[model samples]
Target: MKEIRVGLIGFGTVGSGLAEVLLAQQERLEKRSGLRIRLAKVADINISEMPPQFGDVALTNDAADLIGDPEIDIVVELIGGIQPAKTFVMNAIAAGKHVVTANKALLSQEGRDIFAAAARHGVEVGFEASVGGGIPVIKALREGLVANKILSIMGIMNGTANYILTRMTDEGIPFDEVLRDAQQQGFAEADPTYDVEGIDTAHKLAILMTMAYGMNITHNDIATEGISRIEPVDIEFAREFGCRIKLLAISRNHGDHVEARVHATMVPERHLLASISGAFNAIHFTGDMVGNVLLYGLGAGKMPTGSAVAADIVDIARNIATGSVGRVPPLSYLPEEISDRKITPMEELSCPYYFRISAVDKPGVLSAVSGILSQHDISIESVIQKGRKQSGPVSIVMRTHTALESSVSKALAEIDALDVVAAPTVKIRILEEDE
Candidate 1:
């Protein structure tokens, strides 16, 4: 059997995992693919800490060494960051080597240049593990559901955020408290801003949007909202209304435009996504032909993520052996065929909302809030005014049907202006099953 030599960049969490998978599965892979997969070289910022299993394979602190290594045929990049990782990937592609990466941030931020470099060299770039850690979502959107028009995708993409939210809902704890626990338990990073702030989900959503819609998009265009503002009261209120709150990464393809947004949403309790707990992730995609399909599993882990990287290596090796260069389009369609449509802004999104308002227990307050919604042509689906906990403040739950985000904002603004209301309104997107 011909051997496919691999060069790995960034021996971090995912990189080390890749090494373990290839070594452990080498025998099984050789039987299945009839090819020997070898690690010709590995580049990391700190090579001294690499586990003993790395053995005698060439190791270097400099990434450039791996790009031009003659023994390396396919370059697998797990190095996360903009400058060096991008430079290494582009250089590898320019050197006429196939590339595989799990760097969704880099891809979502600068995929255009990376793909161009691969196209120039007539090679393929595999990123099946980029978006969803273990779920073959990139493959699903790119190949499996190729014939169907993807209507929308709703997911719990960030495992850290999901873990925190799940704990908050189940244990009735505060966000900050659970985040500290997550860090201590190794479920979150020391600086968890990216995952907690919705930036991580935005990157994943950006990649998914490109694959599903064949469109060029960036992380900046997506409307992003973090879960920092989610209150436990809202979670209890959601349960009372038969719902659960989860951070949702959403994208939709309309006839003329595409909508991308990531935010905390109140999904009904019966919804599949709402049931996902802890660090697990799930995504529901509605396609014109396939109707509704779901993919759920460990969104991030050493072994699971490593399996995805190994799968890409097998693909690259098989393609090389068969004398076939290009496999599938990088963005799920030909470069020139990618869409140029704009991503609809958050203010323009249309969906129902769950609002928690604190109002003074006085005459005509409910009518005043309803009047504001009616003025904006936002129809109310239901309203619950809780028993007054105090004479000055009360909690009200208002559920509405589909309406424009701008209209909802305006209505909330008007409702806030009333002297009876105590504070600004807190709004959570409502995802209807049939919508």
Candidate 2:
């Protein structure tokens, strides 16, 4: 059997897990893959103390050692960042080595250049772990659903954000309180702007959109909104409407253009997505032939994500063993077929909306608000007034019929500017999914 040597960079949580999988399951992997897969070297900034089980493997601080090594057939990059990770992966590809990575940020931002370089170098890139860690969604999209025309995708891609929202929905906890608790529980990072602000979800969405539509989309192209503005009162109101709020990364293909956005969306309480609570992740895909398919699992962790990385390694190793490199394109589309598609402007999209307006209890407040919405061509579907306050502002919540985003924005601006309006209006999109 041909021996395919593996070199891993970054010895952090995921890297350590990959090492464990590669070392502990060496014989099993060889038997399953029909090739001798070996962990030849590991590179990290700090390698002062090596793990006892990896005594036979070489360790180095310089990543170039792995890229430059003639025997190293695959370079696995577990480091999460843009700088040196991009440089190292590019150099590895330039050296004619197959690459596997879990860096979503880098791939979402710089995938075109990276994939183009790989194509030029005649090596495949495996990045199944980048989007939904260990969920195998990437593989499913590339192979399993390749024959179908993907119509739409809605996913809870960020664990930190999902965890925060799940707790808020279940316990009626406020966003701030839940976020603090998630941080304490190691579910959120100290500086969680990426996860909480929907940036992380957008990154993963970009990757998925690329695979689904064969389009050149990036995180910057996504219209992103966070969950920081969500409150306990909003969750209560959602329950009144028989719904739950989840931070959703949504994309839809419209023939000429595509829609991509990440925001706090109100989904029907009975929907499967609303029930996906806590830190777990779920992605719902709509394809022409498959109709609707869901993939759910742990989005991030040591063993789960490590398992994804190992699967990629074995796949690439099998390709090497058979001398059939580049059998599957990284994006599941031919390089020539992948091109920039028009992204529909967020303002042009139409959807039903939920609005919470703080207004002083008065005789003409409702009429005035409805008048403004009507003028903007937004019709009210339902309205609720919570409590009565003679002096202070009371919450007036309204659900509107399907309206263009631009019209809603204009109406909200006019309503918020009224003398009776006390605060900026809080708006959330309502997703009407088929059962």
Candidate 3:
């Protein structure tokens, strides 16, 4: 048996959980892999309040001290953000240490430079925990599905936003109310901008695009629309029409171009992703060889994320013992092999739409609404008119067939200009059953 010495940075939620799992599963890991995983040292901003589980292990306030430790064979980084995390990883690689990280933001933003440094140092960068927590989607893409050309990837990446949306749909609560509840329950952050504004999902999508389609993505390149604008009324309307509003991170290859985006989507109730509610995560992958495959599990939390990190630790330990650390590229493709295909713009995206028009109940109102669609060359598939809810106007829901988003915007503009219009039209894209 071989012993692998470990250095951990940041004993926050994820870091502490990693320590817990390693301590609890010590016997099983050694029995299964014939390797003893030892925590040689732990580093955090404040080392004075170290947990009792840390036992007699060495502790330090400076992270670089752990990276430079001669006995540490692997360094696990869970201290997220761009600044010192990036600096720490680079310095660890420079010291000839294998690295495992769960920092998706750092990888998505500066993966190219990090991968280049790892190549120069001849070390493996294991980051399975970055994307879908314990779901193993990264491993599936890089190894299991390597035989196929991925057609598309649509994921429910943010558990916080998903929990809020699911509560709004099931409990008939407003967005703000659900968000407040999520925060109180610790499911959401004090500043929920990253989760609700779609920036967090964008970071995950950038990583997925690199592994699935072999493309380098900058966070700015993705067209992101958040769930902040989604309302309970929209959720009710979606349920009435066999659909659910979910914040989806989607990426697809279109000839020489790729479409990568994160937005509030209306997925059909029958779709597998629609059934995934609360703080769980799920992703549907369409591959040429395997067709549609779904990966579902706890997206985040201490134990789930820690399990993923531990798996990587086991892998690196086995490879180290064999003296043959494999060279599986970080992006799963050589830099020269990745294509320079631009992400398709939002205007080019084509999908059906669910439009709810608040207008005065009067003669010729339906004709006026239909006329606007015709002017934009849009086609309406169905229409539902609800009874008057208020004195000012009533809601008229219209379902349209596949149409370009640019045409939908044009039709919406024209509809809002009518004399009968009460407020801005509420429009949500209607995802197809198969898509």
Best by TM-score: 2
Lowest lDDT 10-mer window, candidate 2?
A: 386-395
Q: What does the lDDT come to for candidate 1? A: 0.88
Off by over 4 Å in 2: 388-391
Compare the candidates by lDDT and give the number of the best one: 2
Candidate 3 Cα misplacement greater than 4 A, ranges: 360-366, 417-422
* Candidate 2, 32-105: lDDT as tens digits: 98888989998998777579988888999889987899999999998888998899999999999999999999
Candidate 3 residue pairs in clash (backbone atoms < 3 Å): none
Candidates 1 and 2, the one with greater lDDT:
2
* Ranked by lDDT, top first: 2, 3, 1
Candidate 2 clashes between residue pairs 3 or more apart in a chain or in different chains = none
What CA RMSD would candidate 2 show?
Answer: 1.5
Model 1: pairs clashing at backbone N, Cα or C within 3 Å: none
lDDT by residue for model 1 (162-192), tens: 9999999998999989999999999999999
Model 1 bad stretches (over 4 Å): 360-364, 387-393, 418-422
Range of the 10 consecutive residues with the lowest summed lDDT in candidate 1:
47-56
TM-score for each candidate, following the candidate numbering? 0.94, 0.97, 0.95
lDDT of 3 by residue, 113-216 (tens): 98889888888899999988889988888888989899999989989999999999889999999999999999999999989999999999998898888887
Q: Which ten residues in a row have the lowest lDDT in candidate 3?
A: 326-335
